[model samples]
Target: MSAVGPLDAALTVPAPAVVEPGAYARLRELVAGGGAVALTGAGMSTASGIPDYRGPDGTRRVQPMQHGEFVGSAAARQRYWARAYVGWTRFASARPNPAHRAVADLERLGLVRHVITQNVDGLHQQAGSHRVLELHGTLDRVVCLDCGEVTTRDQVQEWLADANPGFLVAVDATSPVRPDGDVALPEAQVQAFRPPLCLVCGRDRLKPDVVFFGGSVDKGVVERAYTFVEQARVLLVLGSSLQVMSGYRFVRRAAREGIPVAVVTRGGTRGDAETTVGVDALVGDVLPALVADLRG
Candidate 1:
């Protein structure tokens, strides 16, 4: 493969210095000497067409909905499902790109011991990474609000379609595609699509099994991830901005423990000051190069 240029060479050239050509050599040395952990974020999957939540042209490409709106208003829920029903296929259809596969390869080579990811897309697992901890929940599954039953998102969509025949037709006919949902349809037209209830308990309330902006990650999940970090000699961060604490805390913990940190991502990161090595490059391009250099 051809070498790709730095993602933000203008910003990366001066700070902390570009990830030294020898950084991968050093990482390999550490891995050969002991175990290593990977802390991944949304950037890992951006090449696969899953937009970053906060990118300049991301989900906000359209309007954004708040957590309170989704939880409090029946109309809001209907609108969310209406849009999701159309976009769900696209989101679900996203495949793991080279970056994801590279991480899995690193694990198979014994260079990566654990993967802690903030993305709810489940791309790591799709990429064949076995020992992964999802800091945020996955969108592939849905959880019941009242009964705690979990179901595949496909099933929920089917139920929703059955519950609201011609409802999607209305949105398809008039709603404008927005990151939040179809806003072009009249409010009443959009509100006509009702989400299905939990199948196990027959309650008409189910939510995606993911942590929204204002939601907290499950404590057990966080503890398990910390345990993975505790066992590693180095922490590798890829494709993350570390904007949210859910993913940022691990970087903080690693810094506090004096673990050597290597970051590979596009644009700026919150943990740049804390990282021992920072590579401002696209993961799809840089990860394979770094892994190859490590092998040599």
Candidate 2:
């Protein structure tokens, strides 16, 4: 959810191509294995007042931040924090959409085993899905890379509000909310702004607890995800385009091992070749109906 500038034109293009129209039955059959592991992405959160980086058509709407830029460049850090400060309220206000609720309901019905989400929004958890593994860290929290101090993102926003009064209204007046709790603002505003630092240590780096683009997810987290996939009888991928290899690698591995893989997304996915069933439909529409049918 963090990007500094316009993405290269290559990255901005989307690849959403709707497949055949029978995703509901295909998804049902895939989850019939009774131990399906759910893999989710940004598209899952679009209905919860969040804008996805890639639209339903699979085109990129925003270029995400690279890890090196946030950790290494002071100016990048300031700009990111400035936008995030303004966008925090918008991000915070997002509630779990029906898609999120349906996922949670499936777990309650003993149909889903675990949820592995690429998004950092924590909306799945908010929607009441338990045993969830966030592949990327969450926006709701912050971590001090220096001292390992963990605090709520709200705390940092409060600090930023005190330091940068009138900041949000100034930049937010023009910028719209972007996915990943980000906003697009002018460089002049960013340069004039001051970013937050580690409050506990008084001098060090503080970043949202998310795994940035080009950053590696923690090994322990990756290992745990593999373990879940190993125990799973089937893999159910939802809403992701699988453009990122971190999430796509699991699908590739599952396919190699002959595990049942079903995908329900609105656009073309890099893993379509590997999917046993590919559904081209809106998750919000498909999931709620599926959940209702499951309950009935």
Candidate 3:
């Protein structure tokens, strides 16, 4: 698992330097020499119509739902289910962007060894990446709070549709969608909405099997990421600010191992101190360009 250990707390990262796109070519050269392990963040999916959790300045605009809140309160669960029900259309419809496709192609070209993403969105897998490790859990599955029976979110979505037919149309579809399939809604409406309960137990809660802000990642997942890191010749970070250290710690480990760490993201990263080369350009644009340059 990850040498970074389980995520314990958030870190205070300074605003990162934004450099001109002078190093993308060099980044490609480094990867061409040896395959790199990618640790991706939310920014990788911004091109796929998904909003990032933070802005360029590295500050979150909105507070995400907390694990304790979701588990402790019925109202919190209702609010999450309602926003998720509406946001599922946008989230599910998002296709893999060029960055995702480029990552998959790089692996095919023997330049990428593995992909570990902080994003719950399955864009990387959708783009045909086989060796993917989701650092945070995915939204595609929901788990029972009592019996831990994991069920597909698509199946849950269908049940939701049957239970709440016109509710989706009633809510404004365009309301800002969050990174985790949550849309902003008035508190009253959220509380008023009825969400589905566990089918197996009949009276228990069902939660998306994701590592919430206040939750911990599965240790087994972290260990597998560590194994990937140990085998990688280099570490590549794409589209993440690295505000949290779960992703950053791998970069630190790579640095400790004396391997090169290449970064291609828009904003400041906590791992900037350890980065060997960084390209502050749009990842979608840079990744495709990297692939094309490799072709020549």
Candidate 4:
């Protein structure tokens, strides 16, 4: 994958209402045929009760944990597991919403060919999207950095429960949850929490199977996503700010290849200028309406 910034050229559509008729019409027309790929982000899961990293205005609400820090500092790992252990309960319970269903419906209608998501949450697959690719990896698994053995996150949770009895009960549930599926906690609580060890290696280097900030996605995965976009007629982006280059690169690729790019998201996106049609709205609301319009 290549490192990049914002695109120099853009289509510059005006930001529309929550469900602008004109923008919706253009979106419907673009995806009317099969061969569109849906690239999603945190905003897609917000309807399922999961919060995003940024607000509607596009300002970041919290600083995410970096990969370097998590790998280099033992203290960082301890704090991460503590917050994650508590936050997992809520994150795991998040259900797929209307937008997810609509995207699945698009696939069933043979409009959308594949889904490439920046979200680590597995809601797309849960929503019945068979051709789904995870760009950043999923949180449902754990990897041992020492032995390189992979294990289920459920097993790690069990180990954490055993090591830190009553830890969850002590944590304040109101603490803000981050986009990475962890919550904020006091330093004292974070310090008191004991991190889980890898079952295979019996080492303390168990990390969630996710790409943290400052982490690189696997080359194979990036290549696959590129191929999907390269073959697509339209690149339909849902609920993503496209702030980071990971997802933004696909948008750039679509634009460069003359594939029409449509963005449906709340607030502004870094790829707004590059979009063929830009709709500033909730995807949950827009997608269902689009599905209804297409059916009609």
Candidate 5:
């Protein structure tokens, strides 16, 4: 596989190194002959307005709250909800983009068996892909660490708004800007904002149903994805740099098992050397073309 950057002169000088018009045809040829799977990351959803957590920029945005911090202190919980309250609307209102629809089309054509995604956004399901396995849990849901009660994140947002009316009012009056539900607010205002307690237990603690940096996903989820890989002939990775172990491990696993891996991303990936085929292109542009070729 080529270790080319998006702007590498060799790839971009004359023309882009896009998959031929027969790209999807090639994909179908591979699939009909054997099993197929897709592994996706944040780039797939960037068209929908979500920023890539770690891209070429190398900026590490701080999460709203850590499990250890939220559980240990009341002030931490308040700060979390204050930011989340302002940010939830952007996340909830984001519509799936063309790249999402392209994957669903592939699934409909029976070429894609299962989708393993590192994104917490539920865009794939929203686009009508059924057999999706979320390696990182969905951000649209909330889980109580104490009682294990699961609820939609929308409901949690409502509770947060009610508990912190002042904060909500301030957020509404502002520019309505949000980045992955972590809007930029003044430290003084955020410090003044309070977090909502769990509706069931009435405790000032609740966490989103997402895996954090130091968090470990359930072994069962990992095993299920591995099962998909084991039954598949090819693993197509999309829109991920694979900087994190969660997504990188799958690429390594496929290579070890002799399965061909195809990657489509705008930037360098951690496992580029191990990939069988790497296409450095926007996922939105490449996916639809690939799907069209498959149908042709």
Candidate 6:
């Protein structure tokens, strides 16, 4: 395959699929024959009460904790755990929304063959999408950096509660939780909190089983995502701006392979130039309509 030009270079970028009746029909036609792969991001879960890192304009709303900062400094880890512990309940309580369910429906009807998601929330699986590849590891598990032992997030939450009694009650519950399950808190509160230790090794080196910002995904998982895109009849982007290259690369690959690329998102994305069709609408509405039209 020939190398596609850079996103900003002089190229024939498709006109933005501004929200219109025709855009929906065009989207339906693209995925109507099935064999599409859904590449999802944080917007896919926004309807489930989880806030994405960016806004509709593709601007960053909150900065996430970088992997190096979390791993290299004990103080940083303490701050993270303090916030995460406070935000855990809200994050864990989020459920799959209509958009997620529609994706599952598409899979059930054989419209979507695979799902490659940048989200760590595991909403796809909860929505009944069986062939999901979580490019970023899920937040339900904890890994020990020192001993390489694994444990569940629920167990770690219990350990944290035992280690710091009445800590959760003291924090301001009104503070909004970030998509990564972090909440802002006073410095004093963070200092008073304690991080969870590994269940197997009993050391204070446990981290959530997720790829933090500035972290590389596991190579094997990336390869699998690439393989899926390569074989897909169409690449369907749901709710992602594709600003980050991790998800955008797959769009690039699909475009290079001459596969149809359709984007159903709320705002502008980095992959506009390569898209075969772009739908600027809420995924919650578009997906269900697409599924209905195709199913009929």
Tens-digit per-residue lDDT, 97-166, candidate 5: 9899988887887778899999888899999999999998988888888888888888887776676676
Candidate 4 local lDDT, 1-296, one digit each (tens):
11112223332333235667677667766877668999999999998988888898889888998999999999999999999999998888888999999999888888889999999989999999999999999999999889999988888888899999998889898986678888988999999998988767788989999999999999999999999999998999999999989999999999999999999998889998799998888998788877765655
Query: What is the TM-score of each predicted model, taking all chains together?
Result: 0.82, 0.90, 0.91, 0.93, 0.85, 0.93
Q: Where does the lowest 10-residue lDDT sum fall in candidate 5?
A: 1-10
- Give the per-residue Cα lDDT of candidate 6 at 172: 88
Pick out the ten consecutive residues of candidate 6 with the lowest summed lDDT: 1-10
- Estimate every model's Cα lDDT from 0 to 1: 0.73, 0.81, 0.83, 0.87, 0.74, 0.87
Model 2, residue 88: C-alpha shift (Å): 0.5
Question: Candidate order by lDDT, highest to lowest?
Answer: 6, 4, 3, 2, 5, 1
Clashing pairs in 5: 35-233, 78-195
Off by over 4 Å in 2: 1-23
lDDT of 2 by residue, 1-296 (tens): 11122322231212223434355555665664478889998879888878888866667879887899988987788878988888889889999999999899888878889999999888999999998999998999999878889999989988998989887667655567888587888889888888888877975488899999899999999999988887888898998999889899889878877788888888789998998988787788777766665454
Which 10-residue window in model 1 sums to the lowest lDDT? 8-17
Q: Indicate whether candidate 5 or candidate 6 has the larger lDDT.
A: 6
The reply for model 6, stretches above 4 Å from the true place, is: 1-18
Evaluated at residue 65, the lDDT of candidate 2 is 79
Q: How high is the lDDT of residue 59 in model 1?
A: 26
Query: How much is 29 displaced in model 5, in angstroms?
Result: 5.4
Residue 14's lDDT within candidate 1 is 26
lDDT, candidate 1, 40-94, per-residue tens: 9878987887766666222234345566777777666667776777667667778
- Candidate 1 Cα deviation (angstroms), residue 141: 1.0
